[model samples]
Target chain A: MWRGLQVREQSLLSLLLPGLRSRGPRLQCQAAIRALTGGPGPGPGGLRGELDRFGGITVRLGQLRSADSVDPATFRTWLQGKCEQWRAEGRIAVWLHVPIFQSQFISPAASLGLRFHHAESDASLMTLWLGEGPSRLPGYATHQVGVAGQCPSFAQSNNFFVLFSGLIIQTKNAWKFPGGLSEPGEDIGDTATREVLEETGITSEFQALLSIRQQHGRPDAFGKSDLYIVCRLKPLSFRVSFCPHECLRCEWMALAALATAEEATPITRRVASLLLYGHREGFDKVDLTVRELPALHRGLSYKLYHRDLPELYEKMSAMD
Target chain B: MWRGLQVREQSLLSLLLPGLRSRGPRLQCQAAIRALTGGPGPGPGGLRGELDRFGGITVRLGQLRSADSVDPATFRTWLQGKCEQWRAEGRIAVWLHVPIFQSQFISPAASLGLRFHHAESDASLMTLWLGEGPSRLPGYATHQVGVAGQCPSFAQSNNFFVLFSGLIIQTKNAWKFPGGLSEPGEDIGDTATREVLEETGITSEFQALLSIRQQHGRPDAFGKSDLYIVCRLKPLSFRVSFCPHECLRCEWMALAALATAEEATPITRRVASLLLYGHREGFDKVDLTVRELPALHRGLSYKLYHRDLPELYEKMSAMD
Candidate 1:
């Protein structure tokens, strides 16, 4: 019975999938390139036709494993070409050439209603780009379509990701954290500095590599993405750049108030855990945790670690 | 100075590799999908393409951390299209399906001497396919490829992977023990059984998941690959036919002589270690060292392991 089945399946595969069952890698690469260059086209639902191929939605979980044999450069070039093609077709708006770890820079396009794109090539490499144009908005109000800042804090005591001490920017009774989009290939430290300067006009020195925040499908004022990395910073210097056009005013809120703010996003909630339970001293001696993080930092705490039976069952069954 | 360099690099990347900076998970999956399909023409000296697009090679390495995010079906579909294109253009010959953990089988083209088309897709998945056609020279005698035969002892072995073994087949008279290829989305055990039957015509009962052989690329005659999961198999039944006439003869051989046999490949050399150190008592009472294996199998006795390092390193660096 098994032999006959095997024989039949072989025959079917030959006819159905055909001559490339084994030769897929190269051909797949070509298809991806063609799709990239083929222009997303002006489709009804924006993605402009780009997301149609991918079945819409973006972002997924990533795993970390040692890749001793793979060379990163070979993969980057292929990614570069694909991105270039997208740019030529106007599928992408702006491409940032930032390093991996630097200060954060807020997205100017965020308020302008734009979605960002980041990826490695067919080979493998990091590439970040913007997709689609300004999202058509309904009206202008406190909740209207515009920039949404994402910055989470870490506890200095736990030896994990930590938040820095800096003056906060306030606009129309609303207080917000200063953060920014990263430059291509730029490290996180540099990203933080650039963001702070651009927003608060303050220069800060990074003290440590605090904690990281990651969540999937978390509802937030700005879309469903809930992941953010937190770092500790100390105000090295400060100057008030009150650009009334971009901000109403800026001031250093008390650390206690910053930690207890009512508008704390889920990201901020986790950071508050570290800040309250983790070690801290006088404002000057505030230490940020950069190591010794517990494994259950992300959704692991909610679904896996927390005894949420219903949620746990759902997660487990999805794997099945 | 560092700040200036950061800005310049970011600007260059914005112009060059857009979408190189966003922290998007879908980005990695998309890139991996692209890499799998982006058919970049061969590089200089047949050099494998580099993956660095935004941050040299580091970004590519980051991308690899998310390798599994891309669906295998997507890869399969993309490759099928390429094969059709190649077939239409008259560039491909035999297409062999070698599922992992299961035995490998070949399907001969209706006509001979057809040029097997190299997939223009990502080379990572198809590099093995390119070498799947007729083995170089020696015709039938020198290039005999058969699945390893089973030992009744595997039924009693205490290995985790073997417990699920329903489709693993082992090759016979092979210097080393090469089992079946795992299916598109199957576990290692299922792959083993399926591959073994296709190649050797045996229904193997899984016993235990043994040590992983990571040093050499793939243990089979095929090209270098990442991981090879070894399992113990027990014989249940046999079938009459083998595909493509790749194996002139296939049957059980004494496991003890596996290392010293003239027909043994480098894989056999490693198998010699398992047989010598692996606990056993004839074919019906298989016993394995239930302890977790270290990264490198230590019990194999240093002499055998050391002798193969030079050749192993050659294969390891070959991918680069």
Candidate 2:
């Protein structure tokens, strides 16, 4: 129905009547979608359930990544899940706000990779689109709420994330990293490290590339970006340095503790996400899976035997 | 006539003849092009004579910076004179053996502000289409021949030109810039610097954007890229650093100073151009007109003379 809507922009009720009679029953799909997301009710819930039953998850990821790839059931299911999760988490109980769409748009000159999209209604359970080469893949757009995991080890477990106290530029009498506009031909990593050193007086090393995240519904903004690749850096020395032109203050934040004042405008909840995700997930091993593994691996007697199988990776890659 | 030739595959000659005749004295423009590029032998050297009358000459500068911006010819006579000096010095004579057509080509992104077209004729000059930006301003793509100037303050006094050694990346027993495939949301600059550091173990500060240039007409292959951006960096603590996975050796060199034992590959030439241009012209102040001014006074002169100077600054800002 959504596919037809994108193309013809027709009413869903019109397309459903014929299929309603011949296609057994779609009421289950509608029910599932609704169960996942309480609002916009039953029709969507059933649609979600029906789509999941068919196992067309990849199609949904595509819708978020490209406009051309559409999967009504997948979108419905993802949206429902997000709604349910948010509601259960109490945010929905307060205001019932919906998360919009999100995308990781890229230049064709770049390499081939998967594109994901999150439905505006469901911020989680991003729709994934797979493709090779420069051809545009299908995905969704609008905005999306970023999902960042927080872990305890990132805060105080190591000194790798700290730098010298006096080594940052002071803006309004505070020490901080110096990051501004990206110069022509500069890369993100270049931007990050340069900003840090220029604003604060410390040379640092970029340790690892971490997560790509998005910002949604910024109070002053409209569109949300897809994941931004985050990195971990360790400062080499303590140096009281300041570039009066770029920043007012730079200081070290304990991985375990954060100083939340209006002074740190841009580096808010996001830093916490970066630290926690970087530590707990091992930075490089963040698992972004598409579906729950087969239940037999956990509930059945065969599960024990399956644990020893070596063909798992090969089979998973083949994805029949 | 040249524009007609330019639309070779489209039968534009037949379709636009009436339009051309009605528009202006295109024949004059055709004659002008041929004479400037030394096409058709009896090309009358109209462009050459203009330069001669102005004491300027046109000499071809071969594969240097992959990308560059040509400033508006302010003192056309001086421009011609500069070319004449180079040709007189034998610096421009290298083209005789270089097979003018075997060069790479690059197109400026609309962001950089330049454009070119494939010439109808197979000859190098005829093959290049250069034009000034504003519609009233005419521009032509020429095979540039650069003359070296004396810089006593620097180490070598060749006064002709010097290229940098750092541009070439040698690692993992193979040589390739830290540059690789542009990932989604990446551009040429992002690729260039990343590739440099990835391949070489040194990171530099991006100081200024230099030029956007292109090579043209390679009998054996399609043209590659010439991205020119000026950057400053501290040299490595040691010269033997290698990335076993990406490269085996990385070193800097002055092209003229390179010995037979330190020869470079074809791609190395592309990087050489950037180094040459940066060292000679000063990347931040790329516009030749600015280079012509006394180093201290050019800033004020640039601010006062350029058209829509504010807009130009804005354009530069966007790239930043």
Candidate 3:
């Protein structure tokens, strides 16, 4: 009966339906949506139910139908009802993840008491808190967030060689560069050094910021877009002690060898290519400074091979 | 006397002093510090009193001595006293603009109920409200904020020519590219197109994301940090409508000519250079498809030459 009805009518009919009306408002809403369009909601090997439990049930409206197909008023009524149900059930919060293209839904969601939460690739997370806790959300003073990293290198046989593959323990270990999330109040330079130290046990100095791989929604991003910075670093020591939790191996493979390794992460490959051809081709470098920029709080900036330490650099300088 | 004392002592001492403590706690504290340190206090051409009147008085400790000079506790007390006074006086709000490098003060300020406000190139604006409007501040659901702009180009007589520059009114008329603050819930591409249209009145499509300049603190950033994005654009039409308030004029001069223009903003020159060199280099192009990127609610992405009409594009193709 709901299948032939328009989305607006479907929502209204679902509210009045005998079978679905008795169920939770959220269920009734979903039923109405499912009646119009069918898809596996949360099943084994589908959009995981655990994720919904952990981070609130997310409804991506654009994923269901065309912008013209659904009316904002209809969605708002359904969403508001679902939130009321959640409030009664003591669910702390609910997230309405809307496709970026469905801008018309933004106002409706806002009107439905959903506050702008965060954004991930392809979806803007507008959240509403149903349960009584602190309504205050975390605010990063600066609006911009970024991540910067370094591909540490050492001098060998008069050839400036870069590290190939660092290893991580993600499902039987894979090759990747030493990197992690930035600490609060840490700069790209500091973050690069710190992340490298923790992951690969390397003490290094930043040379030059190399390249940036910034994108908005990614599957792994906690619904927030990120800016990844790549830098070149001059390693001070060869001592290696990989953290078991973050990394299992910290082998310094040559760039050429790592380039051929099929297991290297895509970012690692891209960074390798950047190291090989970036300088000559026209990749820009950024000065590692944070105090000058207030709007950007987090970012990763990779560095370039500027120079070595004084004593070694002097000896190498004389040779060069 | 206070110069030799620790920051904690100074705060305690300021609370105790008689002549220095007669005024409100904040003023008394400052007087106590001033009595000891012998630094200038609220004088002409010091910190600019009008800014204090309009906004709140900003006490940047780094300005007084070294980055390592002031302790967080002293600054926090001084800051706390000021807020209390503001509250007592029934002042609506107050802002504490701290230097970005003075991160030690961040925790203390936060403890004193200072919230992350905004940032500029040179400082981060942390705010505390004294009035009873609402404790909750506006949160832009999108975590990142940035600007993306276009350098529209044309081909003439085998010369790959681009538009020279647009003019903006910032106190006085200045030669600048067309851009402005991102409107609430507006995408960077939309920001770029809208800013361009509003400033220069020239309609164009985004060609590519040219460069990014993100900084936390800037002198003119109103204590808020900003990210300025530069992009390449292809102009579709020559007609223009200049906005009087935002822009004084928009000109399409020779790129070579504008590059050497002595009055051109440094950023303008940098962007012009980017326009000249970006395409051949690894300067990546961004597809202006908002739907494709879920995490990104705002950024600089090029608008594909979305044809207004099939007939017009088809006719143009036939002519070519």
Candidate 4:
């Protein structure tokens, strides 16, 4: 009985939406607009999506009523019809948000050439480009990685415990660590050392990653997230030749003084105290050291940042 | 003498590339294509760009001979001509790579509406979208953040020190922590707890961030970078009701056994040892605690992951 009904609907769909019919056997006939909008599917609004800035449509499936309750076959039919309509309307992209509960719809979506762009704990985002060329749809979680170099002055004797600081041209009277955005394919350590050289003309070696700050909606980063990594550096050359465009002043200041200075940023002050602690107690307590490990793919490696394992524990684990 | 020559060149530009004249007062001419391509500008390749997948062109200024030596005025004129040519060919985007040494060209490029996309230590990449709607160009360093929840079993007594482990269906005999990728706008801790509940049907509370791994060129992530964070969790429910699709088997294994088990992945083994160390000494030694800080924008806050400062130091710094 169900087969007969499906065949009748399929014939009707072919007559009504010729675009869907030409998409091969994958296109199945589902309920029409009246059934989708007025019937028991996707709540009162149905599956209508808002137009995005890039001539794409983004449908938030999670917002639909009983989103997960829809049968997979029915959802697939509906999606095929929607695609045909969107393509005819000159839409360039389609972004579908399928909540984890409604993940059954993912297979149907993927079969239609929709690819997984990214997934969150509650849902996964899939995208399809209907444009002439490749999908110009952007990637997920666009983040800018910035590295700050905390270089303590090279101590000629045991008496000095000063730190080198740069006064940023953009910020009034605020002392900041010499740093900049990490280039594509650049390592954290390499970025820290290189930025220190460019901004302050201080050659340095990366010692350890001290802290990480993750912020979102940065105006400078086009409303994307930013990851700021602070690294301890060992100064190779102490002479200051600061870039006039980047820094107003560059000088060595006492760590204690910087820690209490009202002119320093909160992060800089917090790191200053942390550095003081490391100087007194030991660096191992505060440092997140880097180690390279083989990636799942051959000929590729990744960087893992973690607290250094104690010597005794390392030896014990080595026995395995 | 310079002013007279500049006026002549500007008149010639208006006649040759009418598109430049319509762009208003910002457009200025200095040199022609022969001077730009054949002479000292942008090497022998003559400022030519390769077509991108999205009907755009990408010109790497860093690859040019004496790239930084090009006068900004001359480069500006060359850019105007190229833009006019690209527009006529129905190009959708223009990507210009300007090295730090050649940053003088940035002003001219920005005058033409090219905005900063991303930067490396040596160069900055800028882009302009000429598509009908809006720019669909993707963001830099696309990263997917994945979280793994390490949940120890809920012990009824002091003697039991077991940990819940799941055998991933994708890998043969390899036990992994139950976790998933974080959703957009979700916190790290929230993702850990939510994933554990979804995959294992085990309720857990997020404890502390344990480790971080940054890898690049992941096939699963559309050839972008991946940041995997491991978090410690306190299990609320001990029973295992694993999703069959994601796991082959789920069981509670002794920490000592799992730490030495050959079936465990290298990272799993390493984390196990760290957990053991934390269990014996204290979590404070291995944990990177989370703190909430005010973002630069009003009504927004960001998460900072770092080591816990000593109580004495926090108190001392509080005085400041």
Candidate 5:
């Protein structure tokens, strides 16, 4: 009881005397710049706790963990409770800056009209309007898009492109595609091609669409979803350069080798087989209409076209 | 000469009579829907041509191979040739749909006013306003953002998380984080927690942050760049139930075991060591201003935080 009173007394004194809030002597430093919330007047720097701005409180969310009952409903309820508490505190808006990878809370936050405000270098800003009179609430949709390339082997080698981060580092035994996540406003195809080039330093051309897979219920996904697009690409150059920051080395592995490489990811082998050998068994194809021939390959005068697999087969068979 | 003449005659006939272009009968099926570009226009079903909308001709790009020189200047020259050809063909707006992975052409395309047009499910639309008086080409900045989680070991088991996509598929021998790419607008912290939950079905709480890394000159980046944020997370629930579609299984791995695991990525090993043993050798701590804890941790909150290290130190000191 005495400790509780002491805590309350200290808070009361701190609240009444802002200058006396610090337990230690204030250090001499240059004036701190305003946190770019861009609304309301500037405030002091390095001040712990909520900063009142834009008629709301900017919350610094600690690293979030699932509450004991880590289900979707409970998580949402927890988020709702936080909003309610903020509302009761007479805040007009609740601005939360979350890291850009938290997909689980997006939907729940969206439900509360705390939509995406903008993106920083590493985090996304979300704001929930708490004021009563017709606040502007925008609809937002979030998705995890994993962009990877089927860096196919050259026609002669029949090998697919792969990169080894190194035998001494994180991916010692595993080989990965020169692909990663698509950036904001970047095309998925561009992601695949860039990743391959970045990892292999081999400029590749995007070819046919191989397959797109969507899976949900990932732990990191927070019950959201992920979309992965795998493209069939042809290597135009055989340069073996690579960015050391991203990978240690690049190689053109035979299809047979990739299929059996103990270090290859499950998805990599499947893609090599599908793109190189035309083995599209378990996955469905997305029918795309393209200029009968690719722009670079237009010299061959391949007529532009689009067709389902069955129709395409029929046309070839008819010629035969 | 007879065969060549006959082929020429057939081509001439087909060019003149568009209806008779197909050598075989056209497939009698319901008219196909336009590819779900989520834009204006009802195009002819399965017509092998660019979709005409927004006063532009959507281009189908081919698998690009760099010529022997394989420089950006050369690639740009080749692209310029294609653009010139299209200009001659009277295309006003050249709408090229580059995949997200096509980093090689990004700078060159951006320079040609083939800026970001819009996005579809799998690709980004770049519009090169070739026709008309001063077409509005908006500049777009593209980045590949990767969110990884550093799931810290709980008190009982200094066991970091390691997920297996299963023993059968491509990820047969590999272990991965409970994290992947963050969905659009998702917070990086949320990404760490959510991914852990999605892959492991263990609800984790965001703890202190670990690190943020930015890298440039990635091959797939095509001179663009990527930002990766690795977070320190605390698992709330240990019961890990994962979706079969996402992973084979997840296990809590001891820090020491992970440091030596051949398949573990170098980054993963370093992270495990740092989190478990405060191993800060040969790497700089990314300056992330979260709670002052990390900065203090830099200055021996490091000592206050770890009991094992202290006990070991005390034993060594006593021996001394």
Candidate 6:
């Protein structure tokens, strides 16, 4: 029965040939042919793909025989034709797995409306949605969270406060706040405290969220975006038993000196300055406090971090 | 050959029976039995799993016949036995797909050192890494990034600035800055502008990052954590053709009024205050600016967002 439908589609295409002489009309004719056939038919291009569960087509470019050596212009023309064909066939989405070596084709693909979905070390996945309503395709997550703890030193004299710093083994021994990536299911504060203990053997309690730095395209984060949250932590123990595998040195340094020290990372220095400002002024001016709220799901709760609410707004009914 | 190994493991267990009478030594004996057998031996519990590529084990509790009716205490004991058996077998990781209905088991499992990896509507995937060296398992991303555009209205007069807001159809008609989730690989600024245009038919350009609210356990985000960024936007065209499907109404409201409005979401109100502070004082005090920097990969760049540095620190060497 399907084969018979294909034959009928071919006959219809032949009947419409004369009217489709122009380039634009020819493309439209092919689309109509696809509509009649109920899916993409054999095209002039060699690209091949399988029908996905959603009635979409997913092409793995690296698997093609001529993928590595294919001409960009030819690929672009083929993609353009295929997109129209897929759209007419009522396909909901198009997925293209473009390998790293075929990066040259990325620009052309983007120009034709494909957007980056996510990337691995060897390949980047791009997609285009052709469905009627807004695309139902869920986006892959594009960010990783890293938490750092700024542990204030107990030994303080004059008006100066000291902070613990580690000479990290990973970055040419530059001094930085002791921290690490947040493990799955770990809260920001929990991660900060855990990392501080693991890297410098310091026991601390989470005080408040001080600042956040967001960066994209980090190689260490598997090419995903990164969010680094710096939390202020109050120290419970001052002893330093630094992990030799992760840090070259760890010590307490004056906040003012560390803020200006050439050895510290730019983020560290900037955060130090912010900390100084908070110390001189009030912490409420800079801290983003965390609140635990009941989640929509029964028996579960979620953490919300934002600037502390003023007394007037604190009494307002909670927003969902 | 496998049967022979199992028999030998049983014989070994029998030989160690005297010492294994104690609880501590019983676990040790089971571990030894597993080491000799090269896999988990038949245990007293009914729980089962398949070995993954990395010598890990994955169990889908939802697929079990008795999953929906299992007793929490009994399940905990069974899980404890299974964990010991798997750990003895030198399994690298253990994955459990706990259905929402079986949530009572979550606390027990968590007490046994399992952590949440990710969640879907029907179930939450939890994991435990038992092998040496920090768990080689990759963590599932726990965040969804949402970008909202705080468009400064053109109707602003006097010293007070007006902001565009929509009565969101999804949130009890509460007023909110126009926004949506960031598409995979889209910049925060791009998402803000795109969302503003899509929701209000108002063309805008991203100006600066104003504030961020991080909340965990959002159900609409497939049970992932959420990061909501508010971007200050400069409107290009202000004629609002509000999307009826998304908003009940759209209008420009005075910043002062919106800042204290009870109809706005808590986050919206908080951001309004931040924006008002920026307006009265200096935006430099509140805005986190974006900078494009070279990525580790050739021919790629990443955006970094942080507070603008003071003049003294602005000239410092860029930290990787």
lDDT of 1 by residue, B1-320 (tens): 33343344344444555665454464453453334333333211221223222211110112222324433344343444334323333332223221211110011110122221121111111121222364321100001012232332322123332321122212344333435433222334555566667666666665544333222112232222223345556657744344333455544444444434556543343333343334432311112111111111233211000011123222322221
lDDT tens readout by residue for model 1, A21-66: 4556755633443333322232111221223242222211121122
TM-score per candidate for chain A alone = 0.35, 0.31, 0.42, 0.58, 0.44, 0.59
In model 4, how large is the Cα lDDT of residue A232? 88
> Each candidate: how many clashes?
123, 95, 48, 2, 73, 0
Give native contacts recovered, as a fraction, per prediction: 0.00, 0.00, 0.02, 0.28, 0.02, 0.14
Ranking by TM-score: 4, 6, 3, 5, 1, 2
Off by over 4 Å in 2: A1-177, A180-191, A214-228, A255-267, A273-320, B1-320
Question: B4-75, model 4: which lDDT tens digit per residue?
Answer: 434445566667777765565542333343453232234332566778776998988866666546676777
Best by DockQ: 4
Candidate 4: docking tier? incorrect
lDDT of 2 by residue, A130-219 (tens): 222433322222221121111122122255554212122346643233444333233334555676666666666644332332232233
Q: Which stretches of candidate 4 lie over 4 Å from their true place?
A: A1-126, A129-139, A154-173, A316-320, B1-10, B13-126, B129-141, B153-173, B318-320
Report, to 2 decimal places, the DockQ of model 5. Answer: 0.02
TM-score of 1: 0.23
The regions of model 5 sitting more than 4 angstroms off are A1-141, A155-170, A215-225, A279-320, B1-320
Q: Quick one: best TM-score, which candidate?
A: 4
Calculate DockQ per candidate and list them: 0.01, 0.01, 0.02, 0.16, 0.02, 0.07
For model 5, how does the per-residue alpha-carbon lDDT over B1-320 read when each residue is reduced to its tens digit?
A: 22343344345445655555454443211111012111122222211226364445665433333222244455455455445544545567776654433333445656655554443222345567777688643323344455566555543443444431111111344555656655654555677777777667777666544433334444434334444455566566666677675666666666555655556644454445445433222111211212111111123210011011122222322210
Please tell me which model should have the higher lDDT, number 2 or number 3. 3
lDDT tens readout by residue for model 5, A143-198: 44566665555434434434321111114445757676666546556777887776
Which of the two candidates, 3 or 6, achieves a greater lDDT against the reference? 6
